[model samples]
Structure formats: structure tokens, C-alpha cells
Target: MIQQTLTQLRELRLSGMANSLLSQIEQPATYEGLSFEERLQLLTDSEANDRENRKQQRLLKAAKLKLSAHARDIDYQHPRGLKQSVMASLLQCHWINKAQNLLITGPCGSGKTYLACALGETACLQGYSVKYYRISRLMLALTQAKADGSYSKALQNLAKIDCLIIDDWGLEPLTAAQRNDLMEIMDDRHEETSTIIMSQLPTDQWYQSIGDNTLADAILDRLMHNAHRIKLKGESMRKIQSNLTDGEHLE
Candidate 1:
């Protein structure tokens, strides 16, 4: 029995142990005392803990990025076949410090959202804390918070993130209160943290969309002053793909 245990331990790569009864082994080596089933359970528990540790490390790595995509993958040379210098310049990630915002304006079907999401994804990967919220969803969340008397906490939470990416900024009309809320959030983040505002409307029209001149001024002032504006060009990637594939592939 001792010889058999020693051989098994050797084969298992458990060093410094020979075949010893389960009762005689000390801790750890005692772990070797248990039956194969018990050992398997311990191994399984250890694997699970290792997996969780890896997952947590990945999450931590994603949160530290300030500018999500590094410059090379941005396709600056091609510009997706458009000749826009500004788009390339924005990829440098320098504007983040100027309390500058990113304003992405382009017609629907263009790569506006893709570009914005890519940038946000890059930021996450680079270890900068980022918060991604769709315009409609954010408004709904704020509305819910107001109803629940947690609006202050919600706004404070928004303020804490290092970078906030608001996708689809003008998909719906904003109420007076929502406008104020947005302005306040932007105001707090202005010149302090970085922001990415993705909108289909042109910069000139943002004022009309928001419906309050004072709030609009406050919002745009901070956004444009330090912002690295990128105006994407070309037909919507969606339409182009649909045309190529005859709409057979549904996204």
C-alpha cells in the first residue's frame, strides 16, 4: 500500500510524499490521504478560484484605460476611405487632458456609433474607468432615480467615472428637467474628466435639440472648448453591408 501510494503521488506530481495512510499525512499532504473523489473536489475548487481571479484581473485591466484604442488600429491612413484630418488627429488621445470632449457627428448608417464604441472599448482596455450609457437609457435611469429619490447619488456616481461615453445623444426629445440634469452632469465633468458625446445632429443644431439656451451654452461650451471633434463620413456601414449582402444577414 505504501509503495502504491508513493507511485501515485509521484505520478500526480505531489512532491515529498510517499505512500502514507490518510491518517498519518499532515495538512496538504493529508489532502493526499483523502480518496480520489475528495482530491478531485479540492482540485475543482482550486480551479474555480483561479478562474475567478483571472476574471477579476481582466476587469481591472479594462478599467484603467484612458483612451481605449491605441493609435495604430484606428486606420488613420484610410479613414475608411474618407479624407478627414480631424478624425485622425482625434485618435492621438491628447485631447483627454484639455477637459476636451469627443463630439462624433455623422448621418445615420455611417460609422459614428461604431467609432464611438470602439473608442470607448479602447478606453476600457487601456485601464481608464469608463461609463457607457445610451441617451435614452440614461434619461430613463435619471427619471427612475428621481422617482426613487436617488437622483443625487446617481449623478454623483456618474461624476466619479474617469470617462463617460454617452451614446445616441439626441435620439429623443429632452424634457426641461432632463436638459438641466444633463447640463449639470456635463458641467461637473467639464474641464475635470473626459467625455464622449455621440450625436447624429450637427453641432449647430445641438442647441435646438436641447431646448434651453443657457443649458445648451453650458453644455456646448465645455464640450467644444477642449473637445476633439471627429466628423465621420461615408454611407452608413449598415446600408453598405445590406447592399452588399442583399439584407440577408440581420444584425
Candidate 2:
């Protein structure tokens, strides 16, 4: 009867319950102690938890973030313009719910990617889908997609992501074609989905980086006006890490 029940549970896709049932039957002494309601509760909770865990794993795999960082691991001690209070508010994820964009600006090695990844991970945990891309790489892929007749499909895919993290936003120069492509992407995501852009350049220089004055104006109007900004300051973290090899802490 137990073997038949385990097979039935597996057939019904109740993997969590099947495993729990096997464990319970293996230890009849313990199972005899729990009330019927407690046993049922355990099986139900196990199934629900397993399902949630699988969903989260799927989300994290799809995210493909540059850094494997979590919000709780954020370094507040580094005086790099990060504010724990602000981060705490952001962690509540209210801005994402409202479809607000985040702009993280800083010098090289200021941990922009780390912070962005942390937030992206948070979004994934909250059941929001996320995608990450470097602007240069994303643009190249877009150009390829256009040649293969999947340009529109690519944009549609980008539009569907709940959160898009564009790392190294201003690293590459934008051509006329790339500029238009960017406009389409931003236009689709505007006021509907959240985007986190990490750039080493100051926000003011972004206009110059993304040349074509008219296109720049339109793109910035969409991405900047309603965005929350974080400007990270301080020396390169790389420098600090390099000094740690001598076994002395950075002062």
C-alpha cells in the first residue's frame, strides 16, 4: 500500500509530499506521534515550499546577473556614497512596484555592478523577472537580431522583463542605428517597467556619450526624468583590495 501510494503521489507531481511521505513511513515511531492534522500540514507545507523554491531558482537562472550579490551583503562601511537608509527603502521594493527607474553613477571600481546585482537579485526573489546586459553587448546582439529578422522579437522580449539591468551604460559610443534601437527599448519600458542603469560617467555627460542631440534629448527625457539616482564616490575598491595582499587593512 505504501509503495502504491508513493507511486501515485509521484504520478500526481507531488514530489515534495512523496518524499515527505517516504520519510515519515521510514520512521513510524515519529509519525505515530504527530496528529493527523500536523502530518497533513507538513506535507502541504513541503509541497508549497518546494514549488516556491523551484520558481525562485528559475528566476535567478534567467537573471544571469554580472555579480552574485545580495542586498543584505551590501557594504555600508565603504563610504562610497551608499546610504543604508536609502538602500533600506529601496529594499522594500516599492519603487519597482511603481515602475520607477534607478540610475547608479560612479567612478571606476565604486561597486556599481555589485549594488545593481544585489537589487536585481532582490527583484528576482520578490517574484519579478529580471535580465541583465552590458550596453555594448546588448547593442551588438540587437544589430545581429535585426539582420536575422528578429529585431522586433528582441524588443518585445526586453519589454516583457520586469526589471532590466543595463550595466556599463555609457561605455560604448552610440551610432544612429543604435540610438534608434535604444529609443525603441526605452519607449517600450517607459512608465511601465523598471530599469537599473550603471554608468561610470556623470549623468550630465550621458548626453554627450549618447550623441545625436535630438535622440539624446528624447532618450534622456524618458530614462532620466523619472529615475532615482545614486552617485557613488571614493577611491577604487580594486586599489583597496590590492593592498589587502600585504595583510594590512585599508585605512
Candidate 3:
């Protein structure tokens, strides 16, 4: 009878409850003291928790973050100008809920990408949809989507994400087509979702990188309005953490 009930629970897709019941059956002494309501509540809680864990895994996989970073794993001792107070507020993900943007600017290897990915992971844990893209790759994807006749659909999908992390911003000058594509994406996401932009150049220099008078103005207006900024300043963390000997440098 117990095996039949377990089979039924699995068929109904209540694997969490089924597993919990199997454990209860194996250790009857542990759960025998509980009332029927108490046992039922435990099964329900286990199923809910299992569902939440599965959802988080799906979100993280779909996010495609470059780094496996978490908010609690951020290194505060790295001396990269990261403030605990600011990170504390950001970790709460209230800005994402408000559809605000985050700009993280710093020298290369200063952990900008890690911090952005960390915040993105936090958003995923909080049940927000996130996607990460390098500026060049995203431009390529947009161009490909245009050629494939799915450009509009791509833009619509991008607009629906709760948090979008754009890494390596301003690495190269933008062409006219890429500029237009960026304009479309930014316009779609403006004031409707959150974005995290990681750049080596400072914000003021982004205008020159965009290389257009009119579109640059429009893009910056939408992107920078009410956005939170984090400017990291320090030596390359990679250099500091390297195990390579100074005398054994590779060409």
C-alpha cells in the first residue's frame, strides 16, 4: 500500500512529497508523533522548497553569467573601492524591482565582471529573470537576428528580462548599425527593466565611444537616468593573485 502511494505521488509530479513520505516510512518513529495536519504541512513545505530550488537553478542556467559569483562571495578585502554599505543595499535587489540601472566601471581585472555577475545571481535567487551579454557578442547577435528576420522578436524577448548585464562595454567603437541596434534595445528596456553595464572606460567617455551625436545623447539619456554607479580603482586583482614567478615570465 505504501509503495503504491509513493508511485502515485511520483506520477502526480510531487517528487518532493514522495521523497519526504519515503523517509517518514523508513523512520516511522520520527514522524509517528506528528498529527496528520502536521505531517501534511511538512510534505507541502518540502515540495514548495524543492520547487523553489529547481526554479533558481533554471534561472541561473538561463542567465548565462560569465562568472559563478555570489553576493556573499564578493571579496571586500581586495581594495577595489567596493563599499559594503552600497553592496548591502544592492544585494537586497530593490533597485531591480524599481527598474533602475547599475553602472560598474573600473580598470581591467579589477573584479567588475565578478561584481556584476554576483548581483545578477542575487537577482536570479530573488526570482528575477536575468541575461548576460558582452557588447560585441550582443551586437553580433542583433545583426544575425536582423539577417534571420527575427530582429523584432529578439528585441521583444530582451525587453522582457528583469535584469540584463552587459559586460565589456565601450571596448570598441560602435558602427552605425550597431549603434541603431543598441538604441533599439536600450529604448525597449528603458524604465521597464534593470540593466548592469560593466565598462573599463568611465561613463563620461562612453559618449565618445558611441561615436554619434544624436543617438549617443538618446542612449545615454535613457541609460544613465537615475542609475547607480560604482567606480572601482586599484591594481589588477589577477596580477595580485597570480602564482607565476616574476623571473619565470612567459613570452
Each prediction's whole-model lDDT (CA): 0.68, 0.91, 0.95
So what's the TM-score on candidate 1?
A: 0.66
List pairs with backbone clashes in candidate 2.
none
* Model 3 Cα lDDT, one tens digit per residue, 144-213: 9999999999999999999999999999989999999999989999999999999999999999999998
- Least accurate 10 contiguous residues by lDDT in model 2: 242-251
TM-score of each: 0.66, 0.92, 0.97
Residue 88 displacement (Å), model 3: 0.8
Q: Tell me the alpha-carbon RMSD of every candidate.
A: 10.3, 3.0, 1.1
Report the C-alpha lDDT of model 2 over 1-251, residue by residue, as the tens digit: 98999999999999989988888989899888899999999898888887888888899999999989988789899989899998998887888889899999999999999989999899888889999999998899999999999999999999989899999988888899999999999999999999999999999999999999999999999998889999999999878867456557556
The Cα error of candidate 1 at residue 164, in Å, is: 0.8
RMSD of 3: 1.1
Which of the predicted structures, 1 or 3, would earn the higher lDDT when compared with the native? 3
Q: What's the alpha carbon RMSD for model 2?
A: 3.0
Candidate 1 lDDT tens digits, 147-202: 99999999898887767878777778899989988987987787788988888888
